[model samples]
Target chain A: MEELGPLFVHPYQPDQFWILILIVSLPAIVASLYVLIRGQLPAALSSSLMILLPLVAYLLGDIHLMDESKRVNYCGSCHEAMSPMFETMHNDDSTLAGFHYKRGAISHQTACYSCHSGYGLSGDMTAKLAGMRHMLQTALGSEDYPLRLRRSFDIDSCLDCHAEAKPFRAIEDHRELDIQEALLARDMGCTGECHETAHPEEARHGAAAFAEAR
Target chain B: MARFAALLILVSQLLLLRIVFDTTGPPSTWFTFVGHPLVAAGAVLGIWALTRRLIREAHEHKMAEREDH
Candidate 1:
């Protein structure tokens, strides 16, 4: 028997599941309502069936959509998004992006929303709003926007969930540098080890190489 | 036509999933293929074919009605 992995993981919650269930059942509910209002059983049944097919499709779609690990929503939906960032990743003459993407290292499973978004409502809202703003800017022809990289990667954000499995107790040296100092230096910022590349320069060189090869 | 559209959606979803979930293995084969221009060409052709077929069917149905009149 194939052992299923952990049932509940990050981003998947009881409320979300219930909301999904409601969404999946909406067609049927709407069909029923229509039938009741019109007193037309046969029409209602047909309408219900019509709704049923799409509902199944919706469920399937929801399953795929809800997957936090996929870059479908992140990269595909907003192809123009952080274009420079993706260019840098895929352009690695050394095939760093290709290598990571292939190995699934440079995807939703590891980067973007993972470290940036904290868990629960507050995190989700912040990430989504920020994404919306980015999308708006991208659409409005504001190409000179700054990148999303924080001066210093909030190691605590990474540590929040990962601390239990991989305890990251700050050493004495780690404590020496304050948050402002870390940001200015760009030390301990995101990387392939965290969320792919921390700097645009690294991405550009890597992307140039990757594009040349392909 | 709807079926073809649904299939396209499904395939797109799969590709998106490959982008998102990293299910295509340690070194994502799907990304390489999806990122290729060939896939885009194929998708465009498929959509064009499906749309043309649908329009042809609609035209034929209208012609049949005219003949009946």
Candidate 2:
């Protein structure tokens, strides 16, 4: 009996590289399928030839799964508990997430995570950890529906992009105040009093918003 | 073919999985839930198929030797 290679190993190739691999591997894979399916393999050891097939499909699915986590669309639907919050973002870019994200204030690619995380090495890590907890909560059915912030929204995340911008600094009201002191101290306003809640109480559970999000 | 496809997919996913995981956080448990099963299934099937092929070959070799003797 000939030895067979182990199938499971960590994936480490770059994204663009797959296109090249696929280009080369796909034709052989397809041709091999013709042999495999027609029951007329070139070699009795043809099983070795077909091994790459499942691997490709699995990789594609994995890439998709990864893509889904970062995608606003995917994140919005990850749990029923947070579905409406995501819906609000999708339904009206005019809403807070809409205003900045749809307006490109944050990259649409990093829209939800951009605000949710801070501007440091651990920011993305923090978000991912939080996401894990959310996943667990979702699985356990322990999270409150329409959850509020699990932690205070770090003003730094907002300021990371906005703080130095002339527009934010130049605002007449901001010019008179120590923005960090006020926010970090939790003294008065957050995202300003008028725009306090990102998703309005009504929009949080809007049936239409939720439907369109789907 | 399906098994091969699954193996190819499993390898590809493992190799390129860094794209999704490039971020600094612990991988989402979601990844474990979805990815682990597919990988384990693919690997088990791959091993089983190989084992079956090997056993058949060993039997064939023994029979051929007996005929020659």
Candidate 3:
């Protein structure tokens, strides 16, 4: 398969959009119509079916929504401001996000959500809300240039996936006593000290070039 | 209103599918414009409906009690 491109920048069209629509809509439309045409179901059954059918529809719809959100194109197209970051991810070079994604440490699909998503109760909701804020900021042109994150990336966010992996722990310096302490302390240097950051060299250079050109 | 709000939720979600998954559309569009607004609108409508339902239920109970008296 061709490498996934940014959501909106595809040279060719994909059918996933329609597939999503069909998956979500077909069952719903069918179920609603069935209930409408077959009026006067038993009261108990009517109430149950009314709730159940919509729940089923929601369940299926959400599953497809989750699946589609995993696509790189889906996220990149959502905000033009984020497009540069997507470009950085897609380019080949060993950088923090790019390298891990390319190395398969992160999912090829859902890369954006995987790292950014919160891990505990309401984690997904929190992440999504934060994402919404970013989107809104981007849309309103209120976001700062280069788009600083609210805070530095959390060490826990990295450790969530890496904390258990033998290879992750086995990295040479990461195994050092002080280094381990720092990692636990959520030291910013812990990650960059050994493993690279997610951006590729090309991306870095591209940023530099843009700056120089300016 | 509940029904309308519920429909909005479905509509918004469907619009999001196009925004998120449809690559054939023009590249310049932020499909979220369609999807996100729908979500907000749906939330507002749903809340309005729920409150209305509660008020109606309370009123119905009051009337029923008055009839008994």
User: Which predicted model would earn the best DockQ?
Assistant: 2
Give the CAPRI class of candidate 3: incorrect
Judged by whole-model lDDT over C-alpha atoms, candidate 3 comes out at 0.56
Candidate 1 CAPRI level: incorrect
Model 3, A101-144: lDDT tens per residue?
77767766678878777576476777757755765665666665
- Each candidate's DockQ: 0.03, 0.13, 0.11
Model 1 ranges with Cα > 4 A deviation: A1-42, A50-60, A72-77, A90-109, A132-144, A148-155, A161-171, A176-197, A201-214, B1-69
Give each model's whole-structure lDDT: 0.44, 0.56, 0.56
Model 1 TM: 0.37
Candidate 3 per-residue C-alpha lDDT over B1-69 given as tens digits, one digit per residue, 9 for 90 to 100: 545555655565455445444532232124445544555565565556556666787899999999999
What tens-digit string does per-residue lDDT give for candidate 1 at A54-168? Answer: 3353445335433432343344333443444555445443453444444454343445565556556687676656554554554564534334443345555544543454223
Report per-prediction Cα RMSD to one decimal. 13.7, 12.4, 8.4
True contacts kept of 1: 0.00
- Pairs of residues at least 3 apart in sequence or in different chains that clash in candidate 3: A7-A73, A95-A197, A95-A198, A95-A199, A96-A197, A96-A198, A96-A199, A97-A198
| Candidates ranked by lDDT | 2, 3, 1
Reference-based lDDT, residue A204, model 2: 50
Q: Ten-residue segment with the worst summed lDDT in candidate 3 chain A?
A: A39-48
Note the chain A TM-score of all models in turn.
0.43, 0.60, 0.60
